[model samples]
Structures are given as structure tokens and as C-alpha cells.
Target: MTDPETFIRSTTRMLPVPGVPEIAVYTADEATALWEKTEEQLGQTGLPPPFWAFPWAGGQALARYILAHPQIVQGRTVLDLAAGSGLVAIAAAKAGAAAVWANDIDPFARTAIAVNAAANGVAVGLLPGDIVGTAGTWDVVLAGDISYERDMATRLTGWLESLARDGAEVLVGDPGRSYLARDRLELVASYDVPVPRALEDADSKRSSVWRFRAA
Candidate 1:
């Protein structure tokens, strides 16, 4: 039997993002270094800490949406919250947003975002730190695959509500995590994403993209 860590590492590299249909933006060199560092730090750790990781299906879905509906992002300042690999942020930039900011607490993610942004031929402002207390005004806020944990989902929903109340549009892409509050969420679009086993409890599952408005 293969070790879970080895399996995870190998599978992560092969994970594909639907709709993008392009190769992984980062080079093999960068990905190798990232995998080594992440495994060294998190291999034994029971639960992986929230970090700037990449190739998440939810993020890809949101990115696809932005690219397909460029009008939603056109001429707007967009915030990609918990931006791992800056996928959604890159899409926002490609979609002609006036400005794009990618925020994440993980330093590795920050570097990845910068590299990915350059790879995608777009400019993304990288913001480091927790977005909960960070204050900035934007026309749109993008969140992807954020509702994995219960507490995290609650916190994120609250933050999103606050931002929505302030007139910022908040869009979340998830695969129906248990923490998502159906009462307040509106289904925008859903997709049958190909997710890696390491990223999800099941081997693979189809996911959904949900959009919400300030109530």
C-alpha cells in the first residue's frame, strides 16, 4: 500500500482544474520545492493548516465563471479572499477588472500567487495576513473552497455577509461542505469538478458554485 503522504503528493501534482484546460501554471521546479516544503512541515501533522495551495477545483470554478462572465468583473475592483495560487484573482485580472487583490495568510501562497499571476500574464496585488480585520473597499469579493471546516465556514459566512452589507458582491465556490448555511446562500452555478482524493474525503466528487447577495 502506498503511504498516504506519498499518495497525496503524487496526486496533488496531477490534479486538474476544469475549464482552464491548461498545464499547471507553476514550473516543475517551483512545484517540487513547494511539495517538499509542505510535506516537511505538514507530513505528520494530522490536519493540514490553511495555506496558499493551488489547483483547487472550487477556485477553478470561480475562475471559469469570471472568465465566462467578464461583464461581472469589468471595471470593478475585485478581492480574492484566501487566495491560494491566486487563480480567481488571475481570472479577475484577465476579465478586465479595474484592479485585483489577492489576500492570503500563508507566505508560500503569496509567492505562488505572484508567480502564477506572472505566468497568467496578469497583475495581482498580493496582500498578506488575515482578511477578517483587514479593511479595504472593493466592488467584488471572491471566495473558493473556503467552507471545508465548520468553524471556518461560519466565520467566512459572517465576514461575507458583512462585506455584502457594505455593498460588495461576495461570490463563493464550494463543493457542498457541511458548514455551508443553505438558508442564506443562493446557488449560482454548480459543476462536476474532478477533485483529488487528498483534497477531499472521497476519491472524487462533483462540486457546486454558490452566489449570495446581501440580505
Candidate 2:
């Protein structure tokens, strides 16, 4: 068997995007088990828990949106919540956000964010902990693929609503998850994302991006 650490390090290297200038993203695919091993290695330092790495479809949609509409983030302070691989955060920085904060519960995720940011040649502030304690308001709050579970969806939606009430723009990207609250969300854009066979009910599934505004 391949050494898990080496496998993860090799698989997660910088990825280039076609036709997107100064834009690239890090993705965790089937080899995510290797990433888990990296997290174990990080445990020796007594740092925060490593954020779980997933397919990152939500982040991809958010990144595509930012690239298509650069004006949304230009000169604004942005927050990327549950930023798994820092794809949304990196996109915001590249789109000219004045500053970008990438928050996640996983320490390994924070490290990956740092590496991806540097690879993309943008600066991102890594917030390694729950989002509750993070201070300061932002012009925009971006989230991706966070509504898989009902309880988590409810709590996250509540928090996003709170941020919206405070005048912060809250946007979420999802692939039509069952737990998503359709009533409170608006369809900003949709894409036919390629869902891996392992993640989909069938061979592949197409996902959509839904944006939520405070109601």
C-alpha cells in the first residue's frame, strides 16, 4: 500500500484551470483518505482538528461565479466559511477582495488553505476554529456544500441569516441536497457538475448552485 501521507501530498498538488486567468484550485478526490492520514500526522503538534476534505463542488461553483462576476468581490472584505480547500477564498482574493478570511474547523484544512493561497499567489487569513468566535463583519460570506445533514443545515442557515440581517451578503452553493431549505434560498446560478460515481446515486449526478438571502 502507498504511504498515505505521500499519496495525499501528491494528489493535492496545485491544479490548473483552463481558460481562467490567474485561477486554479485544490481539490480532494477519491484519494481523500490520504488527506486523513496527513491530519493524523498533524495531531502531533496539538493543533486544532483537521477539517474534513470532500469533493469541493460547492467551492467550485463559488469560484466559477467569482470568476464570471469579478465585481461582486472587488475591493470588499470577504469571509469563506467552512472553506475546505480554500477554493472560494482563493477565488475571492483573485477577484480583488481587499482581504479574505478562510474559516474552518479543521487544522489540516487551514494548512491546505495556506498552501493553496500561496500557490495561487493570493493572501488569505486562516481562521482555525468554529465561526462563532471570529470577530468582525464582512461584506460577503461564502459557503459551499455545507447542507448535507439536517441539523447542520439548520444551524448554518440560522447563522447565515444572522449575517444577512447584519447587512452581510450570504451566498451558498449546493447540489440540490435533500436538507436544503428551498423557501429561503434563491437560484443565482446552476451548473451540471460531475459527481463521482461513489458520491452519486447513479453513475454521475448534476449539481446546482443555490444562493440564500436573509428572509
Candidate 1 Cα outliers beyond 4 Å, as residue runs: 1-16, 22-24, 27-36, 39-51, 201-204
Any residue pairs clashing in model 1, and if so which?
none
Error of 1 at 99 (Å): 0.4
Cα lDDT of model 2 by residue, 1-215, tens digit: 44533443565545553223356655455544554555465554444323334445566677778877889889999999998778789888989999999998765577777877887889999887777634448998998888888988888887887787778888887777788777887888876554445445544344555666665
lDDT for predicted candidate 2 compared with the true structure: 0.70
Error of 1 at 208 (Å): 2.0
Candidate 1's residue-wise lDDT over 152-178, tens digit each? 888888888888878888898777777
Q: CA lDDT of 81 in candidate 2?
A: 91
The Cα RMSD in angstroms, rounded to one decimal, for candidate 2 relative to the true structure is: 4.4
Best by lDDT: 1
